[model samples]
Target: MTDSPEFKDEESIRRGQEFINEVYRKMSRIAEEFAAGEINRAQFHRLYNRYQRQIMTVSQMIAESDPSGWETAVKSDESTLHIRRQFEAKAIGLSIYDNRTGMPIETIGDFSLDAELIVPMLSSYRQATAEIFQAGVRSTEMENGQWLCFMSGAYTTLIVLFSVEPSSNRIMLLDRMHRDFEIANAEFLEHGYTSADQLAYPFYSFIKRSPLDTQDLETELDE
Candidate 1:
C-alpha cells in the first residue's frame, strides 16, 4: 500500500504542535476551573463550546497550513443560541437546524441559503453522498470561493459557506467535519434520534438552562 502523505517539515510540525498544545493548555485550565466549580455551569459550557470550535479550527489549520482559517469555518455562531441559557453573559449566536426538515430550533442569526447557493450545495451533497455509498471514504468539495461541502454517509452531511474567501486547508477542513459526524452519529446511534433536532437536544438543553449571570462577572483589570 502507498504511504500516507508526509506532513510538513519537522520545524513546521513542531511549531504546529506547540500552538496546539498552548490551546489545549488553555482549554484544560478552563475545564479544570469548571470541574472545581470556580466557574459556574454556564461559564464552563461557553468555554467548552468555544474550545471545541477552536480545536476544529486548529485541526483545519494544521491540516491545511493556512493562516486565515476562520473564514471557512462553519458558522457555529448559529449553534450558540441554543446554549445561551448556560452562559448568558457571553454574546453567542448559533442556530441549529434539521438537515433533513430544514426547521430551525434556536434562531440566533440567519444562515439563509438562496437558490443560487442551495443548488450548488445540494448538487455537491448529492455527488458526495453517491460516492460515499459506493466507497467507504467520505468526499468533500470547495467551489466558487464561497462554499465547502462534505458528505460522509446517507444521513450525514455538513456544509460550510462563506461570504468571503476561506483561508483554510482543504484536507484539515474535511478531517474536522468527519470528526464531528463521528461524534454526532455515535450519539444518535446510542439514543436512536432520527432527526438532527434530536441530535442537537443536549446542546439546546444546556443553552436554555445555563443563561449567564453578568452580575457575577468581575470587570477586567487594566493591563
Candidate 2:
C-alpha cells in the first residue's frame, strides 16, 4: 500500500486543508438537501458516504504532513460552516403549452427537444397528475442530470428546461411567472388565444435571464 502524502510547507498544508474543508462544505450541503427533501435518503446516504470517505483520505494525507494541520482547520471550522452556499440553475429553454390541446403555443431558447417528443411526455404527466397528487410545481431531473420545471396554470402549462436542479427561489419565480402569464393574457386566453403574439409573452424576457438572479420576477430588471 502507498503511504499518505506529506507536505513540508505551510502553503501546501493550507491548500490541502482547504480541499478537506471544501469536502466538508459539500457534505454540509448534501445534508441540507436531505433535510429539505431535495434528495432522497438513498441519494443522501451515497453522497454523504462518498464525501466522508474523500475527507478521510485527504485528512490522512494532511495529517501525515503536518500533525498540526487538523488543528489549523479546526480553528476556522465555524466560519467555514457559516459560509452561504448559493445555487444557480441555468435557464436552458422555456415553453408554453395549451392545456386543452396539448399544443405548444410558444417555445424559445436553447433547448434541443422537439415539440413532438414533449407533447406525449406532457400528456403522460398530466394524466399522472390528474390521477395522483397534483402540486403547483413538478421538478424533474433527467437521467443525464438535466432539470425540467413544470408549472401549470389555468389556461396553459409552462415547461422550463434548466441546466441543473433549480433552487426553491428560482422555482418560486417560475411559479409566479406562470401565474402572471395567465393573468396578463386572461382576455385573449379566456376568449381564444389563436396566436402566440395575441398574448403578451411575459417569459420572453426571462429567457435572457440566465444563471438566475437572486431577485424575484416581481422585482425583475426592466430591459
Candidate 3:
C-alpha cells in the first residue's frame, strides 16, 4: 500500500482549523487552571500576556494569508517558562527583549537573530506592502527544502520550516499573503506606530523625501 500525502488540500484546511482550535483550547485551559488556583497569579499573568501577544502575531499571519502556517512563542525573564499553547507538532520558541534597551531579557531556546535572514525578510515585507498597494504579484523561495517565509509588516515576519513536507506553493501563498498583509497593515497603522523609523529604529537617520516639519509631539510641553 502507498502512503498518503502529508496533507491533501482538504486535509490541509481542516488541519489548519484544528490547529487554531487547539490553540484556543489550550489558552482556555490555562485561564481556567489559573482561575481555579492551580497556578499562581504571576503565572496566570504571564500566561495571559503571552496569549495576548500570540494572538496578535497569529492574527497578522492569518491576515497575511500564510499557507505553510505559523506559530508563536512567548517567553518571560524567569527560567520557569512554559509553552502555554502549541498549535502544531513543529517547534515554537520565543525570546523576550527589553523594548527600551534592545537587549534580550529571555529566550526560550536557541532563537538567534540573524541579520542575513532578517534583511531578506524585511525586503519581502516591503514587497508585500507594495504589491498590495499596486495589486501586483509576489513570490517566495524555499531554501534547501527547509524554510519558508512571508512578510506581514516591517516589525512582523512569518517563518515556517518544513518538518514533514517542503513548501511547493510559495509563490501563490506569497501573493495571497500579501493581500491579507495589506489589510492587517492598515489596521496596524490605525493603532499607531506606522513608520518603520518610529517602531524599529528610532535613532537612525534618513534623507527625508520632503522637508521635515515639527509635529505637535516634537514641540516642547510647557511645564
Candidate 4:
C-alpha cells in the first residue's frame, strides 16, 4: 500500500470508507469461489487483475483528497460548454447518439486526453444498455468513480463523462439536461430529425444557457 496522509476531511474519510466497502464487495465473492476450490490460482489472478486498476484508482483518489498531503479539488468552468475538476483541466464531455443508427449526433466538450480509453468503454456500455433496456432499465450507472452515466430516450442515447468524481449535484444537473433535451427536440424527433446538424444545433443553445456550475458542490463540501 502506498503511504497516504494521516489527516482527511469528513468527506474524504467517507470516500475512503466507500472504497474499502467496494473492495470487500468485489473480493469477497471471488475469495469465496477460490476457497471452495472453484477456481485455480491462475483464474484467481486473472479475476483480481481485471478490477485492480479501478480499485487502485479509488485508493489513490482517497489519498489525494486528504488535506494533509494533497489539495481538495474544486470544480470550475473550462469553457462555455465545458466544466472541469480542479485536479486537471479535463472537462466533462457530453454526447448524444441516434440509438437506432448508433451514429453520434453531437458532442460537447473535449475528451481528447482520454478519448482513446473512453471510446471503447462507452461502446461496451451502450451494447450492455441495449440488452438491459428490454428488461425495463432505462438508465444505469457504471464506473468506480461514477465518472460516466448513460441514459436513453425513445430514439436517442445520452452519454456523460466526468473528469472528476461525480457528486449528487452534478448528476442532478445531468437529469435536467436530459429533460431539456427531450422537451427541446420532441417535435423534431417525433416527426423524424432532418439532419444530424439540425437536430444537434438546438442543444448547443440549451446547454449554454443551462446550469453546469459546480459551485453548489463546492459549497456543500465546505459545509
Candidate 5:
C-alpha cells in the first residue's frame, strides 16, 4: 500500500495505529463468533469483508506515514478483540403462518413489527399478489428502512424481518430453510390440522447456517 500524500505525518501515523487496533478488534469479534459457532461462515464473510475494506483505506495512510509499520499494523489487527459484537444485520423477527387460514403458527425473535406491517397488507394478499410471490422469497421495505421478507411453502409461509435489506445470498438461504421446514414436516404440514409442537423447527437452523456454507451449497460440475 503506497502513501497518497494525505497521511504523511508522525501524528497521523500514531492516530492511525490506534484506530487500526479498534478496527481489527472488531474483526476479531466476528472471527471469534464464527469460530465459536455463534455465526455461520457466510455471515462472517459478509461482515469481515466490510471491515477488511476499511483496512485497505487505512493501509494507504499507514504506508504514507511509515511503510515499515504496515506489517506491524496487520499483526496488531488479526489479534481478536475481547469486546462485544459490533456489526451484522439484526434478525429482528421470524414468523410462520398457516396458508389456509392466514393465522400465525409460530414466531421467533421480534414480530411486533410484523403485526403492524403484515395486518394492513393481509387484505391485499389476494389473487392479485399471489403470482408475484410464486417465484421465490420476496421482500418489502418498511418505513424505517428495515426489510420484511416472506417465502411461501406448501402449507405455510415463512417471514423474516431484518434490520437491513437481506442480500440475494441470504434470500437463497431462507428459501432452503423454508423448503427443509416443509419437507421435514410434510406429513404434519399437509395433514388437515396440526399443532406447532408436533412440527420441527427447521427454519431455526437458519441462524446456525446463516447463508449456508458455500461448500454445502455446491454440487458436482457434471455427473
Candidate 6:
C-alpha cells in the first residue's frame, strides 16, 4: 500500500495532534452545551459521536504514519490514556453486511460479541441518528459490566466487546481492525460477495480465538 502523505514526519504528526485537540475542544464545548441545556440530548449525542469518529480517524492516520510515536503520544495524554482503558476488548470479529439490502451477509465470531447484537446496534443507530449510512462506532451496554463496541466501514463492521474487567484504548484498535479487514478481504469486499461460508472460511479460526481465552491461559500458566 502506498504511504499516506498526511502523516509522514514529526511536523505532520504535530499537526495531526493539533487537529485532534481541536476536535476534542469542540466535543468539550458540545458537552458543556448539553449540560447547560442549551442543546438537546439528540443534538449533543450526534455531534459528540461525530467528533469521536473524527478523533479516532485522525489517531489512526497518525498511527499509520508512526506507530511508536502514536503509542508514546497516547501514553502521555491523560484523556487518551483513559480512553485506552475504556475500549479494551475481550473479543473482536469482522462482519460484513449488505448496505443495499440492510442484511448481515456474513459473521465470523465465536465470542461474546455475537452476531445477534449487530441488528440491534444498527437499529439503535437508526433510532438515534439522522444519518443511517454514515460509518462510525456505537457501543451497547451488555448485562453485567461488558460493553459491545461496534465500528463500521464501507459495507463491513468490526465488533469488539470489552471484558468486564477495567480496560482502555478501543477507538484506535477498532480502526486498525477495520483496516486489516479491508486488506484481508479487499477482493470480496470490493466485489460485493454475500456468502458467509465463502467469505468467513478463512477468518473463522481467528474469530474463535478470543483474547480473553489467551488471558485465561496466561493466568493458568502463571498459576
Top candidate by lDDT: 2
Indicate the TM-score of model 4: 0.41
As a whole number from 0 to 100, the lDDT of residue 118 in candidate 4 is 50
Tens digits of per-residue lDDT for model 6 on 119-156? 77766664554366554567666777666666666656
| Alpha-carbon TM-score of each model against the true structure | 0.31, 0.60, 0.27, 0.41, 0.56, 0.41
Quality of model 3 by C-alpha lDDT: 0.42
Worst 10 residues of 3 by lDDT: 201-210
Error of 5 at 132 (Å): 4.1
List candidate 4 stretches off by more than 4 Å. Answer: 1-91, 113-123, 130-146, 194-196, 200-223
What ranges in model 1 sit over 4 Å off?
A: 1-109, 115-120, 132-145, 151-154, 170-174, 189-192, 195-197, 200-223
lDDT of 5 by residue, 12-95 (tens): 667667777787898898788666656544467767776786578677956765644554655554322321133334567788
- Model 6's number of clashes is 6
Candidate No. with top TM-score: 2
For model 1, how does the per-residue alpha-carbon lDDT over 70-164 read when each residue is reduced to its tens digit?
A: 43453444444454334433212223333454443233223455547555655565665565654333323335423333334334433443322
lDDT of each: 0.46, 0.70, 0.42, 0.53, 0.67, 0.58
Tens-digit lDDT track for model 3 on 24-66?
7768987787556455344556666666565565555555655
| TM-score of decoy 6 | 0.41
Q: lDDT tens digits, residues 128-207, model 2? A: 67777655788788878878888777788889998767667667777888898899889888876648757766666667
Q: 176, model 1: CA deviation in Å?
A: 1.3
